[model samples]
Target: MEKHSNVKSRRKHISPVFHLQTKKEEDQHITKEVIKSVRRTGQLNLSSRHIATVPEKLFSIYDAEDENTVDWDFGKPKKEEDAWWNINPLSHLDLSSNVLSEIPAQIGMFQDLLVLNVIFGIII
Candidate 1:
């Protein structure tokens, strides 16, 4: 009998459903202090009536050295850090209207976030 080597090769793919379902929302205990550091030096924009959750698709919008000024009309939210914190600073953000009683502490997950502007409502 002669010895023989066997080899197999195939590309694998994962369902989008599984990928979308895994990014869990942050908990409610997030503190303002942890998120406050990024608020300094840069301006903020808070949107009125934010969608239920930040989309996973937005994770690809990173531009480390873009240095582009935020659009005031759009009231865009941005990251304060120059480095990637093993996460997309733009994703998983929350910008509710001024009508909101309080900002969910869960926003602390945006550890490197920068701006938070109010679009239509006030942040009372």
Candidate 2:
């Protein structure tokens, strides 16, 4: 009877429902970090990260700045101490080896994007 009670208590404390919720929370946290980092650095390397869906933030990072777009000169000579703020617009995006089933239509926002690596992602 004591063993059965202990098992019942453990079951209550370690339910599969709790585990599923925790997993969803963790995935959201990771996705937030990825979006924040990519927005700040203008680069995202999510290769082999098991990402299933392309987040919306990745597609709309430039929408708010449409009217205030800065003209970054990618052809100008750069000094050794030049700040990274002069870097060109996000030109390369690597989404290789992820689980992405489709490239969203919002991808058209990246007009200046030069390279988009979606190698080995989901065929659908």
Candidate 3:
């Protein structure tokens, strides 16, 4: 009675890859990455995702005083000539095709918001 070694090896190889992380862990990782990028660029495009509500991070990011969020101080004194803070603040945001019931009041915090697009979505 000889067992097939190849069949057993296949299961061992595939199980580890799929069982590496849970769904919650993956979602947290993605959220963290998005926050990091938004802090640096001050711009975000979350369109056509069928999101029911806006991410809370978008509202708090503008006023976040901690080290995690970006404090966009564009006109402050800088020793470096090409510092990122010296650049212009966030000026645009696109939240289209999402099932948003109403625009959040926190949007007003974005003083640099010049253009906003919310088409084909429920807005109250």
Candidate 4:
């Protein structure tokens, strides 16, 4: 029996192409970017896929009082069947373990609150 060398050794060809566009159209095509912050928390792990890599723009919101929890700490939630994605994406949030008697009306500051964690604490 002979082994077949099926691998092609040639590198694929490439073409350098450029398309013309109007300034207004080009500006419209570009999506606005949200502020990003790098976190070094030990417990949180990166997701297999990142929203940042999505074709469209994405943003993040975080709970101030959380330390553990990956899914809640990393990415923003997708819009539900009825709900829709917001113009400003809220990708990260850390509303962890800082439970209060009531959530403040000011919570609306986080316009894109995709990951909102509300952990109740033991008061013993």
Backbone atom clashes (below 3 Å) for every candidate: 10, 0, 0, 10
The whole-model lDDT of each prediction reads 0.37, 0.62, 0.60, 0.31
Candidate 2 per-residue lDDT, tens place, 1-124, comes to 9999999888888744222223343255345555545556567676665666665556655444347766577765355323355434666788897767778787778777788899998748
Question: What TM-score does structure 1 among the candidates reach?
Answer: 0.26
lDDT of 4 by residue, 5-107 (tens): 3233222344324233343432332232212222221112122221111112112223322367434433445433212232234434433333123444555
Please name the candidate that would achieve the greatest TM-score relative to the true structure: 3
TM-score of every candidate: 0.26, 0.50, 0.52, 0.24
Best by lDDT: 2
Per-residue accuracy of model 3 over 1-124 as CA lDDT, tens digit each = 1367777877787743223233343233336556556656666777665555666656654443467856467676344523545444556677787667777787887798787778887676
What C-alpha lDDT, on a 0 to 100 scale, does residue 9 get in candidate 2?
85
- The true-versus-predicted C-alpha distance at residue 112 of model 3, in Å, is 0.2
Weakest 10 consecutive residues, lDDT, candidate 4? 49-58
RMSD of 3: 10.8
User: What is the C-alpha local distance difference test score of candidate 4?
Assistant: 0.31
Report model 2's TM-score to 2 decimal places: 0.50
